[model samples]
Target: MSDQLFGSWMDKRDSNWVVFAYFDWIYSSGMFIQMLECLSKRWGFGTDDVDCRFPDNNSFDVDDHFSGVEFSYGLMYDPDVVIVSDEEFGRYLDMACFKYIERTPGSAEYVRSMLSRNEPGNG
Candidate 1:
């Protein structure tokens, strides 16, 4: 999008089974498709959208700002052969951010940036 499509996180382990997507408008179908192909291989997917996610906290509170990534197989109700706990999602999210956003990008600043906009009076 705006040269920045990211998933924010303080730590890799901050969210397993979630991708806290932070993006900017500038959708390019070609770029998006290509990214999926490249990212899929890295994420153990032969062909599918890697809409990963990271829970901001242990409470598993879903952020209202973004819906995060969607899985091709379906929502992750239980970890399976596709994904085991530990380092699975963090690595994927990191890979996506690196490829789409920037090298070593993604941090609390991105998340906080959204929180600031989610004001009490501002719809």
Candidate 2:
């Protein structure tokens, strides 16, 4: 297992979800377990190995207030709870990117630009 942490958007059977996953190499067993526990309490469960179908639109949205802290610690949004509307899903996706990837220097602008390009009526 690699030590790096990673995140991505996913879907299954027309259901949409987001995931931030990592191997044990990056987090100690205790810490990893704690993280999962916190996630279960806050957002939802952490899957070991799972597979699902992709969304038809292939786009998501992030809320303006979404912070990356939860995702940085490995949060997976439960499809059942997340609304399927494009605007809301896009907000969630934006939040995930901002918190997970845009934290690094010079990433915010790039991410925002990418998101804008993908938004409806923009392209």
Candidate 3:
């Protein structure tokens, strides 16, 4: 990936999930896992390649150039879960997580393995 994309990925990975009062998607942890699976398929990553950021109030923007959109959270949230309406947003999330994991020295090995597998799932 290009340095700009890599930097964007890293920024989003470090951002915390915003809890919004307006959205109550009622998603379980299983939803997160399923989302990961879906993202792996769309982004050509792997099932175990994605990671989740802990919930916090920090503001950040996840820019997805592929879909020509940007996902912003935190400022819009109000202590509940922020419901993302777009499915393509998940791919950006996965990319961010993958980038974060891959940058962690020894952790890059796992990312390399996952990317090399090239197994596609339902995005």
Listed in order, each prediction's TM-score against the native is 0.24, 0.35, 0.27
Question: How many clashes show up per model?
Answer: 6, 12, 2
| Global lDDT scores for all candidate models | 0.34, 0.37, 0.33
lDDT of 2 by residue, 68-117 (tens): 22222223433232223445545644554455343344656655555666
Worst window of 10 by summed lDDT in candidate 1: 20-29
TM-score of 1: 0.24
Model 1: how far is 20 from its true place, Å? 16
Superior candidate under lDDT, 1 versus 3: 1
User: Evaluated with lDDT, which candidate comes out highest?
Assistant: 2
Name the lDDT value of residue 59 in candidate 1: 47
lDDT of 2: 0.37
Taking the tens digit of each residue's C-alpha lDDT, what string does model 1 give over 1-123?
344354343234544323322111111223443333333333222223333332233444444123233332222344211322334443454455445534324544553343333333432
Superposition TM-score, candidate 3 onto the true structure = 0.27
Q: Point out the worst 10-residue segment of candidate 2 by lDDT.
A: 50-59
Better of 1 and 3 by TM-score: 3
Worst 10 residues of 3 by lDDT: 20-29
